[model samples]
Structures are given as structure tokens and as C-alpha cells.
Target chain A: MILGVDPGLTRCGVGVIEAGANRRLSFIHVDVVRSDPHMSQDLRLLAIYNGLAAKIEEFAPDTVSIERVFAQENRNTVLGTAQAAGMAMLAAAQRNIPVALHTPTESKMAITGNGKAGKIQMERMVARLLNLNTLPTPADAADALAIAICHALRPAGALEGGEREQHLTPAQRQWAQAAQRANHGRGVKRGM
Target chain B: MILGVDPGLTRCGVGVIEAGANRRLSFIHVDVVRSDPHMSQDLRLLAIYNGLAAKIEEFAPDTVSIERVFAQENRNTVLGTAQAAGMAMLAAAQRNIPVALHTPTESKMAITGNGKAGKIQMERMVARLLNLNTLPTPADAADALAIAICHALRPAGALEGGEREQHLTPAQRQWAQAAQRANHGRGVKRGM
Candidate 1:
């Protein structure tokens, strides 16, 4: 099972998925963690950290997939996104969960077979791929599911050759090794 | 003693000081926490978070002072600063330490009596105010000391009036309340 996080201060999308044999993917859960804009910045981050920590504890995902943040037009939003992403990554690292960061383009291509797919197209493809009857609400959750599915379908080390690859720190590499060791004995093989 | 943090991903400056009777401030310690730029983004953040957490645990400061982040010419630097600042804030909030944020101008005015003071002037004033025999190295540490001293001299609620006031969120307010309650029984009355 893989847990994907779409990090944001206002709304963080989270999803869990299992990739079965022959590339079949099953969705187990999807939701959004929200912090009010009126809350203090640190407090909002605390909420995200706590929310994600709890979900990771409950779901016990074998791997975590997160959207990689890059330069954006809106500086304010980018700051918030960076903070949110930092906290999410921390949550996973604290739990020794191996994290795989996918750029928006990488995730779009993996799910929709088009690197430049639009939001609606990605959402529709994610639902169809997961065999969901209705589209996920708040859009954030759907985006998160897409990230999870993308990671599920991707081969190990597939994400190691992009701008997102620059973000792979030594500690993360160590955690990836540790997570690999921990998952070796389990019956369910992590696709990544 | 209060610890002031000048948050940055590459170089985070930290300083500790005590507010003596009649407004005389005594510098206790000064240092910088750094993360390598070449490291993975998440690992860099983890290093910062761990560094600040260790400092807070060892120093047991009554309050934390931090420089508020503002938009900068370089968006990438701003994003890194925001993430580092968030981690610093989280470190204090986790320890139930009250935090006081001061703008760069506020710290400059408090240390040098000139809001438009240059870096050299601010460093000189910090050295003079702290009765240091030598100037602090790595300019970032001096700026941190200035922030700590500024918060030590200012009254509570002083930061509520500036443009920085717009950034306060509800979680910060709650942490402020909690810090207030925690500090009520301590002998060292917080300066802010």
C-alpha cells in the first residue's frame, strides 16, 4: 500500500492505494486535511503535522508519495506550499517511511499518459484508473490519489532522474534503505 | 534567557540573552545552525529541525525571538527561509515556549536606534550593547542577537501593530496563551 500526500497549508490531500498483480490498483482511502487560513502559521503547520502523523500511524503505508514543489508564480502560495511539504516530509521521515517525490508533470504523465495533462483530465483519469464511480471532492483528494497511483505504477528509481531528483538528501536515501529492509519480510511487495 | 533565531535554510543564526534589571541585556550565547545546500531538500530541513530542537532542549530559554520573513527579490531564497522559519517556530511551539517575532526594521531600530541601519552598523551596535570584546562572526549570528535583544526590550503586544501583524494565525494565538500560562510561575518574567 502507498500513501500519497498533496501538501498545502489550506488543504492537504491524502490518499491510500494498493497495487495488486498485473498492475491493478485499488483505492483504500482518500481525504483532505485542512487548516483554517485565520490560524497562526506555525499552528496551521502543527495541525498538518499532527493530521498526517495520525493517518500514517493508522494506515501504515509501505511508502509515501508526495508532490514535489517547484518555482511558482505566486510567492506567498509557494512559501505556504514549501512549509507544508517540509512538514509532510518530516512526518514520513520520523516514521522511517520511504518517500518518493513526483513532480506534477511526472504524476500527470504516469496517470494520464500525458506530461501536460490538465487538472480535469488528471482527475478523470485517476477515477477511471481507480475504478471509482464518482470523482473525489475538494479536488485535492483526487490529486493525491493520482500521486499514489503514479508511484504505484512506477518502477523503483524511476523518479531519480528529474529536477525532483535533486531533492533526494542523504538522510532520505538512508530511510529508503531502512524501509526497504523493513518491507522485505512482508507478503505485500511494494511496487517501488 | 531568550533565544533569538534568524531563520534561513543555509545559515540559521541563533543567540541567547538575559534581560537584566533596568533594561541592561546580557548576552549568553550565539551560534549558527546550517544545512548544506547540496543535500536533499528534505534532509536539509530535517537537519535544521534537529539542530533547533537540540538547542531549545539544552538552553531551556524562557522565550524565542525570530525574524519575520518577508518577500524577497529571490523567490527561491524566500521559500527556503519560510520553511526554515516554520521549523524554528515549530521547535519553540513544541516546547511550549512563547515566541516573539520582530521585523528586520524593528530589530535594527532596537539595536542601533535607526530603522534603516546597515549591516555593519547593526553588528557594531549589537557588539556594543552586549559588551562583546570582538564582533560576532558570520553576520547572521549578530542579526540574531539583535532580534533577541529587541524582544527583550519591547513590551508584550508590541509586534501586533505592524504589517507583520497580518500573518498571525489562530494556532499562534493559542500557543501564545499557553506560553503565557507556562511563564506566569517562572521568576524570569518574559520581556514580551
Candidate 2:
């Protein structure tokens, strides 16, 4: 099982999925953990930390995947996002779970075959991939599901130093080819 | 007792101080908690969290004062600093201790009567204020000490909406006068 977190101060989205053989993934859980903005920063962070910690305890995920926050984004929200992301990571680490970070572009490309895919497109793709009857509500939750799927589909040894092509499963290769085609054969780096 | 933190991923500085009546301050302890940069980001953050949590447990401070982090600083280090700051806040919150945030300018002005004081000057002033025979070794440690003193000397009800001037101790009034004189009577906002 893998847990993916889309970290934010007001609303932190968490999604859990079980990955089977041959790039198969089954949705296990999805929800948003919220904290009141009126609360003090320490209490707000503690609430988010408690929420994420509870999820980790209940789910017992093997690895936790979190979005890689960048300082280049909206200056007002970046620090809060980074703080929430840190709490998510700490929750996982306290449980001795390894963590993986996936960039937004990587998640979009993994889910929708395009790095610049729109939110609706990404949500629709995530729903279809998970065979869900309804789309994940709130863009943050969908993004988290996409992040989990991205980690689930990642070829082994891709994060480390190795020839990614040699480790790609048939499904991953097919997805990579589709992503490349979607990019107009521009040669999108595999598993980047 | 107040605990001040200068948060950073590689080196988190922590200082404890007791605030006595009439603006008198006594230093208790100061140290730097460090984590290796080569470790995974989650592990590094976890190490920081553990170190801070341990300090809070040992010291049992009434409040934790952390330097407010801004995203405008060095883009590379701001996120890490924010993350470490989050951990510090969480550690305090876990123990139900109140948390205070002071900007670097506030700390500098509180210590040296100058918002733009250089590092050496600030460290010397902090040592003098603490009556320490030796200066705090690392810059981060001195910064933490400054943050603690800043919180210790802030007039009660200054953080909330109130007339700060009515609550200022004689020493605080004297310090404010000195700071104003240092700023060439530019009327620096009190307890801002």
C-alpha cells in the first residue's frame, strides 16, 4: 500500500492505494484533512500533523508519497504548503515508512499523458484509472490520487541510479509511449 | 521560561531562558541540533522533529518562540527553513505550550536597538544582554538566544490588540527609547 499526500495548511489531501503486479492499482482510501485558518500556526500545524499521523496509523502504508513543493509558486501559500508537507513527511518517518516525492508535472504526465493537463482532465483520468463511479471531489484529493498512481507506476530503480528502460514493465512502457506521443514525440524523459 | 528556535534543516538552534519580573532575563541553556544533509529529506526532517521534541520535553518551556520564516529569502533554503520551523512549532504544540513568532527585524531591534544590526554586533549584544562571558559559538545559536530575549522582553498584551505603551516595563521603556534614539527618533513602531 502507498499513501500520497497533497499538503496544504487549510486542506491537506490524502490518498491510499494498493499496487498489485503488472502496474495494477486499487484505491483504498481518499480524504482531505482540514485545519481552521483562524487557529494559531502551531495549533494548525499540530492538527494537520495529528490528522496525517492518524491516517498513517490506520493505513500502515509501506511508503508515503508527497508532492514536491517549490518556493517559486504563490509566495503567500508556499511557506504554509512547505510546512504542511514537512508534517506529512514527519508522520510517515515517525512510523519508519520510506518516502517518495513526485513533482506536479510528473504526476500529471503519469496520469493524463500530458504534463500540462488541466485539472478536469487529470481528475477524469484518475477516476477512469481507478474504475471509480464518481470523480474524487476537490482538486487536491484528485491530485493526491494522481501522485499515488504515479508512484505506483514508477519503474523500480528509476529513483536510484539505473537504466530505467530495463526496469519498465509492459504497462509502464505503453504509458511512456503514449505520453511521448501526446508530447508529439518530443522525447519526454522516461520516469523523470 | 521561553524556548527560542532558529530553524534550519542542517542546523536547528534552540535556546531556553527564564523571564523574571521587571524585564530581568536569565539564560538556562542553548544548543544546536544538527542533521546530515546527505540523508533523505524525510529522515532529515524526522531527525529535526525528534531533536526539538526532546528539547521541549526536557525544558518544559511555557512558550516556544520561532523566527518567522519568509519565502522571499534564498529560494533554496527558505523551504527547508520553513519545514524546520514547522517541526519546532509542532513540538511546542504537542505539549500545549503557547508559540510566538518574531521576525528577524524584531529580534535585532530588541537586542541591539537596530533592525539592521550586523551579525557580529547582534551576537555581541546578545552576549552582553545574557551576561555571558563567552559569545554563543555558532551564529544560529546566538540567533536563537536573541529570539528568546525578544520574546522575554515583549510587553504583555503587545501581541494582542492593546495599548502597548501602557504595559511596557521601565526597562522596556528604556530600551524603546534607546531603540528610537538609535533609529534617529524615526518613531519605530513599538512592539511591532
Candidate 3:
């Protein structure tokens, strides 16, 4: 099982999924853990930590994937996001489960084959890929599922270039080809 | 006892101090908790959380004071610093100790009577106030001590304007007068 988290102070999104043979994915659970804004920041952070810790214990995921945060993004919210991300990472680390960070662009590209894909497009892609009949309400949840899928499709040790095509499953290879086609088509259109 | 933290991923500084009648302060302990830069971000954050958690458990402080972080500061280190601050706050909250945030300006003002006080001046004031024969070696350790003193001098509920001079002890009032004098002297000099 792989768990994906979109960390935030007010509402942290968490999604768990399992990858099967041939790279098929199944969604296990998705939810938003919320903390009151009126509460002191320390208490708010502790609430987030506790909420995520419980989910990790319940799911016992093999690996945890979280959206990587950058200080440049949303200056007002970046600090809280970083703090929330820290809690998510800490919860997984305490259990000895490996944690991975995927950038927003990486997740968007993995799901919609477009690094700059819009929210609705990403959500549609996530629902279609997860084989869900309905959309993942509240964009954060969808974003989290996309993060998890990004991890599942990533080549092992791909970030460090430790793995190559030979290690990719047939399904992942197929998906990679499709993404490349999408990227090429977009590039050509922009060049026009 | 009060615990103060100067949060950073590379070296989080912690200081424990005791406050007696008439606002006298005694330094109990001070140390820096470090996380290796070579480790993964998740593991490094976990190491920080564990190190601070252990300290909180050992000292059983009545309150935790941490340096407030702003995204405007050094973009390169802000995220890591915010994450470290989160860990410090979480460690205190988990143990039910109240946590307070004091900005660098607030700490400096409390220690040196100048919001723009330089590093060397802040260290000297912290050492003098704590009656330490030698200065707090690492800047982070001294910063933590300064944060603690900030909280100790602040009037109860002062941040929210809930308390007034009637509640302040003689020592606290005297320190406040001294700080005002320093600020006035600096203003006069700058005008000249």
C-alpha cells in the first residue's frame, strides 16, 4: 500500500492506494484531516500530527508519498504547509516506513501528462485512473491521489537515476510512452 | 521552569531556565540538537523531533518558547527552519506544555532594548542576564536563552493585551524601565 499526503495546516488530505501486478492501482481510502484555525498554532500542528499518525497506523502503508513544498510558493501559507509536511513525514518515519516527496509538477505530469495541468483536468484524470465512478471531491483529496499514482508510476530510484527502463513494469512503460506523446503534442502546439 | 528553542534543522538550540520571585532568572541547561545533512529530509526531521521530545520529557518545562518563523527571511533556509519549529512545538504540545512564539525582534528587544540589536550585543546581554561567566558558545544557544527571557519579561497575556502593569512584579517593571531608557538613548543618539 502507498499513502499520499497533501499537507496543509487547516486541511491535510490523505489517500491510500495499492498497486497490483502490471501496475494497476486500487484506491483504499481518502479523507481530509482538519484543524481549527482559531486554536494556537502549536495545538493545530499537534492535531494534524495526531490525525495523520492514526491514519498511518490504521493503513500501515508500505511507503508514504507527500507533496514537496517550496518556500517560493504562496508565501503566506508556505510556512504552515512546510510544518504540516514535516508532521506527515515524521509520522511515517516513526513507523520506519519510507517516505517520498513528489513535486506538484511531477504529480500533474504523472496524472494528466501535463506539467501545468489545471485542477479540473487533474481531478478527472485521477478519477479515471483510479476507476472511481465519481470525482474526488475537494481538490486536496484528488491532488493526494495523484501524488500516490505518481509514486507508483515512478521508476524505482528514478530520482537518483539508479533504475532504468528494464526495471519498469509493462504498464508503467506504456504510461510513459503516452505521457511523452502528450508532452510532444503540447510542445508542437505551443511552437506553432 | 521554561524551555526556549531556537529552531533549525542543522542545529536546534534548547535552553531551560527557572524563574523565581521578583522575576529573577536562573539558567538550568542549554544544548544544541543537530541532524545530519546527509540524511534524507524525513529522517532528519524525525531525528530533530526525537531529540527535542527527549529533552521535553527530561525537563518537564511549564512552557515552551520558540522563535517565530517568517517566510520573508533567508529563502534558502526558511522551509527547513519552519519544519524544525514545527517539531519543537509538537514535542511540547504532546507533553501538554504550553508553547509561546516570540519573534527575533521581540527577543532582541527584551534582551538588548533594541529590535535591531546585532548578534554580538544580543549574546553579551543574554550572558550577562543569565550570569554566565562565558558567553553561550553557538549563536543558536544564546538565541534560545534570549527567547526564554523574552517570555519571562513579557507581562502575562501581554501579547493579547490582557494584563497590565498592576500584575507585573517589581523586577519585571524595573527591567521594562531599563529597556525603555535604552531605547530612548538609542533614539537620541540616532537623531544627533
CAPRI-style grade of the A/B interface in model 2: medium
Off by over 4 Å in 3: A157-192, B157-192
Candidate 1 on B1-192: residue-level lDDT in tens?
Answer: 889999999999999998766457788998999999886666788889999988889899998888887665466687788889888878887887878777887676566556688998888878887899888888889988988987875534423344433333333234334445555766424322
lDDT of 1 by residue, A134-154 (tens): 887679999899889878766
CA RMSD of each candidate after superposition: 11.1, 5.2, 7.3
Tens digit of per-residue lDDT, candidate 3, span A56-142: 999999989999999889998999999999999999999999998988877776676677889988888789878999999788888
The predicted structure with the larger TM-score, 2 or 3, is: 2
Candidate 3 C-alpha lDDT tens digits along B103-167 = 88777767776778899998988888789999997888988888888888764433234345555
For each candidate, the DockQ is 0.25, 0.54, 0.43
Q: Once model 3 is optimally superposed onto the true structure by TM-score, how far is the C-alpha of residue A150 displaced, in angstroms?
A: 0.7
Give the alpha carbon lDDT tens digit for every residue of B1-192 in model 2: 999999999999999989776556788999999989988889999999999999999999988999999889999899999999999999998898989998898787677667788999989878877789888878889899899998887644343434665556454555565655645657443321
| Clashing residue pairs for model 2 | none
* Residue A165 lDDT, candidate 3, scale 0-100: 58
Can you tell me which runs of candidate 1 are displaced by over 4 Å? A155-192, B155-192
lDDT of 2 at A146: 86
Q: Residue A55 in model 1: shift from native, Å?
A: 1.4
The interface root-mean-square deviations, each candidate in sequence, come to 4.4, 3.2, 9.4
Give the poorly placed runs of model 2, Cα more than 4 Å off: A157-171, A174-192, B157-171, B174-192
Candidate 2 residue-wise lDDT, A19-102, digit = tens? 886456788999999999988888999999999999999999998989989989999899999999999999988889988988
